[model samples]
Target: MITMKEIARRANVSSATVSRVLNNSGYVSDDVRKRIMKIIEETGYIPSEHAKALRTKQSNVIGVILPKLSTETSSRLVNGISEELAKHGYQILLANTNLDPEKEIENLKLLKSKQVDGIILLATNRGQELVSEIQKLSIPFVATGQVIEGVPSVINNNFQAAKDITSHLIEKGHQKIAFIGVDEADWEVGHRRKEGYLAALKENQLRIVDEWIQKGIFSIESGYTSMKKILESGNERPTAVVCVTDRLAIGAMEYLGEIGLSIPNDIALTGMGASDLSKYVVPRLTTIDLLSETTGAEAAKTLLEIIKEGNTSDKKVIDYRLIIRDSI
Candidate 1:
């Protein structure tokens, strides 16, 4: 029978390194990790969970709380998290909130009741109530997409990315640009994104029409309504429009079509979030790639570190890119 010690011997690493690779406790370079894993697979060696359970008292399950399961963003996040967690022999207990903030709190406690080793929240709104509930958790925890005070998180650069994309429209001679965003409850997506757009205009010394800035929920229909509002705002029509999300942008596009407005000809449009639909749309969307998968992977890795080593970074920022496509 293949033993861990023998596996270590074959892999030319200490048993502790093999243990780290199996236990997901310590850092092992990807090269060494792959080599050890390959040997384990060839030898058909399975570590005894009974011993691991006794030593660590861990359930080997991670609880993931998501705002909504149906969205492309949520799906990509889950794929990244699951891929990373699976490397360490951990499974996910998914908790879908369906975009309700209150459900986030409820799922936190529910995951705790399930005796999950750790919890990760794909946060939507960082309300005080939700933050307070998270603070009460004794187990390892991580948040993605939104930062909570003193909590470890992996988030996209909403502010800078938003500003840069807005600046792109400006560089294309779009001084009369409009913005469609969400409510301020979602601090990062709502407030930070809006602030970034506003900052870009300020830097370029441009004036914004009062009616150009509109707010809506995270929905396609809401986006349609918001864009309708922007166009009918006044005699001064914006040459371009920026929507906070791809879903919103798609909705806006539908509205533009209904009114027989040609994209980038009648009015240029931009959106954040590089969703799948963005690529295949009538006019490919010019949007920001938020690296949703990376966000999930980073949060999962951090949560594992917290659970195993009791040490982790308080915050990690994910990267994003502005994708210029046919729409803009």
Candidate 2:
């Protein structure tokens, strides 16, 4: 590797002069600075980020903790975050948990130890253990998805989104509508969405069927299973279904298809997340768009605000829009 000493010798300047030019500190003649910069560009000399971090106490990097990198929502969110952070000369170090809740806390500690200038957590569950660990972080931190009290977060109005989608089904005259959701442990996707669905039903004065409300995991297979259980529960078939996620809705749609059911004609369907699949599916799915990429962008923006300005808003709420497609 060509060292600064070599560049100094080539430029006919002392090492101190080269150092001053690299750091942009003290003084260096404009001609000499330009010459050194040209040499750096020609040689493709990369500065030691580690050395800079130690000297300035800034990593110029942020750590991002996400649940599963494979999901469409997760990938879009990361893209949004990377795009916004890049504008501010910040790079992201990613830690994917593959949906394991424990890994969220572990990555938190790990990122802290790496001396990241800040952290953006793509939170899944708002568990006490995870919140406690987050509270202990010493660096600028922001989260997206689930909310954490007193901690800045970027979130979608899951409850309101759910209520609106359910109400949409109601407006289409779907009084007997089934709901497919995940475990309530996922406060935002599960508990909050269920609450919204229930609220919409109660507002419309529709009877709630216990068996029509099904809980499943975050998988298409789980969605299929939940839909199957709902149908076989010996209750009258619902006119429509509201799934908390597109994957779940897809699975349910598949199941309905296998049973010779035609969408909208047989049963209307609505999903959340507005994944690409939702737009291309047969009959196209009427779904809720969480604007996931915007959520990620806001999370990174909030963290940078905290790191650079020593201040940030408590929360940023990204509005969810009801996308009208043919499925509903």
Candidate 3:
């Protein structure tokens, strides 16, 4: 392996001069930099990141804790994070918790031990245990998808997004609207979204039936099962339904199709997350675009800023777009 010393020797420069050029830390003449770079290119010499980190006390690595790895939202967010971090010569150490809350805390401790410069958590819930664990970490931490008090986060306005979608359904003359949401333990997707749906109904002077509200996990099958129960519960049925996510809405659509119910004609449907499947599904879903990638990029930027500067609590709320489709 060709070392920086060899490159410097061949380029007729000192090792410190090569270091200054490669790290871009100190002043070096353009001619010297060009010569060193040319010698490095010719030799195909690669700098040791480990040695660089030791010298600078910066690993140039960010730790990312995700709830799940397979979801579309997660994939897009990661792509955005990767794109933004690469520009600053930073890489990510991914820790997938597979939707386990305990693993979130565990991953935080583990990543901190690995000497990551900072951490970005795609949080599932705002449990006190998780917040307490985060407070103990010395490095900068940023949360996405959920808010934690006293912690910096990049989040979507779930309440307002849900309210907008519900109000849109009402404008389409949907008086009887049903809601499909996740467990309230997840404040962003579950509690805030349901609160928005209820708020819209109350503001519009529309009646909400207890039977119309159903809870489901974040899954297609869960949505299907929830819809099935809603359909079988009572003689009174909703003219429209608002789901917390596109996956759930797709599952409900599948159930509706199985029951010979035509979308919009029989029941209008809307969902959050403008997923790829949303467009391909029959009667293409009317949904909210939470700008998952933008949020992820923003989170990466925020964490980097905190790492550069001192830690300060800040929250960034990304805007949402209501995507009107054939479903409604």
Q: Tell me which residue pairs clash in candidate 3.
A: none
lDDT of each: 0.91, 0.91, 0.93
Clashing pairs in 1: none
CA-RMSD of model 1: 6.4
Q: For residues 1-328, could you state the per-residue lDDT of candidate 2 as single tens digits? A: 9888888988999988887887778889899999999998888887788877886688899999989888999999999999999998899999999889999999999999999999998888888898889889978999898888888989999999999999989988888999999989888999999999999999999999999999998899998999999999985899999999999999999999999989989899989999999989998999999998899898888888899898858878899889999997
Please give, for residues 119-193, the per-residue lDDT of candidate 3 as tens digits.
999999999999999999989999998999999999999999999999999999999999999999999999999
> TM-scores, in order shown?
0.85, 0.94, 0.95
Superior by TM-score: candidate 1 or candidate 3: 3
Instruction: After the best TM-score superposition of candidate 1, give how far the Cα of residue 325 lies from its true spot, in angstroms.
Output: 0.5
TM for candidate 1 is 0.85
lDDT of 1: 0.91
lDDT of 1 by residue, 216-254 (tens): 999999889999999897777888898999999989999
Task: Give per-candidate clash totals.
Answer: 0, 0, 0
Evaluate residue 304 in candidate 3 and report its C-alpha lDDT on the 0 to 100 scale.
83
List the lowest-lDDT window of 10 residues for candidate 2. 47-56
- The lowest-lDDT stretch of 10 consecutive residues in candidate 1 is 48-57
